[model samples]
Target: MNVFDIFWLFFMITALQPILRQRFLEAARQRMIAKIEKSRGSRVILLVHRQETMSLLGFPIVRYIDVNDSEQVIRAIHLTDKDVPIDLILHTPGGLVLAALQIARAVKRHPAKVTAFIPHYAMSGGTLIALAADEIVMDEHAVLGPVDPQLGQFPAASLVRVVREKPLDKVDDQTLIMADMAEKALRQMKANLSELLAGKYEPQRVEELAETLSQGRWTHDYPITFDEAQRLGLPVSKDMPTEIYQLMSLFPQPVRQQPSVEFLPTPRKGHEGGQGTGLFF
Candidate 1:
């Protein structure tokens, strides 16, 4: 080929490399999903969001659970046979409350068992969705967060508390209005959470759990570990499937020119060559 023709061919391959790589990764994920489904005899649905970078521009974009996500998940559930169980793999930092509620209600209504697997963290609305599952399987160090509602940038519970504690004259009119809305949001969240927890826990326990989760007892980003979750009477277990981890690896963060973290892909033991080695820092 002439020099110009060779250059054109090279440019085309370079431009298509990212697209081809993404397609290959998606196909790999599908194969892994099929393998997991076949082994467990259950429907697998993933609600994962990563801070992805825009192609070419390299601008970071954060994804959250939204109406679109809820629609897709509910549709997936509808397609599933009522007799088949479902395994939802969640890895998110939470999102819209309405969207989360929609997904949670769908999970609660399914006739067969539903299991939520958290390989990392699922906060806020993500935690709300987890509450609807019959069982929660978490990695040993995985965490969940409070399901408290938020009003704009502030927590709904906080807004209500400020209104209650502060003098009426001291609070601004806008603040007063937000506080009123906050109270309603809190009540709605508590009721919905209780509904999801109903039948799974005792009547009294359900009320207590709902209050604790929706009353803003913890910060929005507070992490609830497996032990803490169990102490709170959540149905959580540490039995993460290996394939789940494999599947997560396929959904990588957007690549940067230089990686921030790097490590050798080899397992290390305390002893090297069958002999204890001197400690090094």
Candidate 2:
């Protein structure tokens, strides 16, 4: 082919790539929705967000980062009538704390029982959100990480470097300066974590966990298996089969209306009853 023809061909491929990918994604999403709809027993609303790493049948897989937008979750929750229950299939590395909290709160507030299904991993803020659900279901290989706050690269790494270089006996001006900045970063991160862990853990324990996480010493901290989560005061169960992972990856769509338990509405006009039926779920 001529040089100009080759250039044109490259341009065409680059231009069409995104469009073609988008079309394929949409088709896959439709298939998943169809599958879920065809399943027997119980009504379920599948909530997927765009922050997920993978897109099955055009629908974004569930991710912690995706839940940061409370409005999106609120919209989705509003779409559900008081009649149906929900099964939240989660696979995320975690994201913003406030967003996760908001999602968890919404799930708790809903009338339907929210069951968080972890087919892969739920780390950091993802763990926080999982706590809000009535029950958490995991496959054999699924895991949950600690709810430790991170200070990011520039802050945490720089501080550690300064601390290492400066000895107690002798310290240069630059080293002292970096050390101070690092200390401040660490303090701020700790405080943020403490706030997030309010009512969940004591301040001192939260600090300890935050430090370990911020330091990034281990590849992963508090890597709890499905059984461990149950032992740790979490309502956890093993339901999804391992083969489902392969099926999910290939089909990219979830079967709809699978059997799931619905959350009962809070009663009105009693000791814990100041709200109306409209406020339930």
Candidate 3:
């Protein structure tokens, strides 16, 4: 009831409010993860690809799942008990081909059901992994993209098309070499697709789906909406579980990157202070 006591109470509330809120949010996130795990009778695993978002003026962005992500994924999978199903929350722009296939097979062969939840989009390699899931859940607005593989930074289909459109003899030596590489990429992708679709689809549909997805019919980034996926006979549903949304809420928004920084310039041996540029996120 004294003026000084009231003022002290106000200062503490102002200082502690943010901390309290953050703690509450953290607890909620864990609860959501746990609830989803309990409901599915599976351990939850999140695989999010790096977003090409801007970073802080001089900071590094957190890396997302790419082809190199297989090592970590396999480790994570092994950490879980064998009896638990895998509730995979997949969000990626796609990465390495071999890496994707490794993950897809792991999920497909797992004894328990693997349910893939797509809150927004999963493209290329991400699509391959989703196909491995027993069930894929998405919202009406969510999308799964085409599975056309990328060879390095180049699109496999484009590379193959160039060779198809131009006669091999007409092209230069370098072009011929690239065309050969492209041909190999196409063949490898076909083989991978066929294997991936093996147990998931009927013997007939498997071939058809593989051709449609990997034959460059659609662009690599083309968004296949929930309705389109269902039409294609994928095991997909538009109704996403509430727990999934709650779990997604814990992550930085799609456009936002966690604050991080990486310094460039390899510090030489015996070098004390090497100048470096900073990438901010």
Best by TM-score: 1
Model 1 lDDT at residue 80: 100
Question: Could you tell me how far off, in angstroms, the CA of residue 162 lies in candidate 2 after the best superposition?
Answer: 15
Better of 1 and 2 by TM-score: 1
Q: Put down candidate 3 lDDT per residue, 202-279, tens digits, no spaces.
A: 899988988888878887778999989989999998668867865765654333355355344343344456554442
Could you tell me every candidate's TM-score relative to the true structure? 0.94, 0.56, 0.75
Show the lowest summed lDDT stretch of 10 residues, model 2. Answer: 40-49
lDDT (C-alpha) at residue 134 in model 2: 68
Tell me the alpha-carbon RMSD of every candidate: 3.7, 14.4, 15.0
Q: What does the lDDT read for residue 227 in candidate 1? A: 94
Better of 1 and 3 by lDDT: 1
Best of the two (1, 3) by TM-score: 1
Q: lDDT of candidate 1 vs native?
A: 0.94
**lDDT-sorted candidate list, best first:** 1, 3, 2
Residues 67-101, candidate 2, lDDT per residue (tens digit)? 43566766777777765666666666777766766
Candidate 2: segments with Cα more than 4 A from true spot? 1-10, 37-68, 151-220, 241-281
Per-residue CA lDDT of model 1 for 1-75, tens digit only, reads 999999999999988888898999999999999999999999999999999877756789999999999999999
Stretches of model 3 off by over 4 angstroms after superposition: 1-28, 50-62, 254-281
- Residue 269 displacement in candidate 3 (angstroms): 64
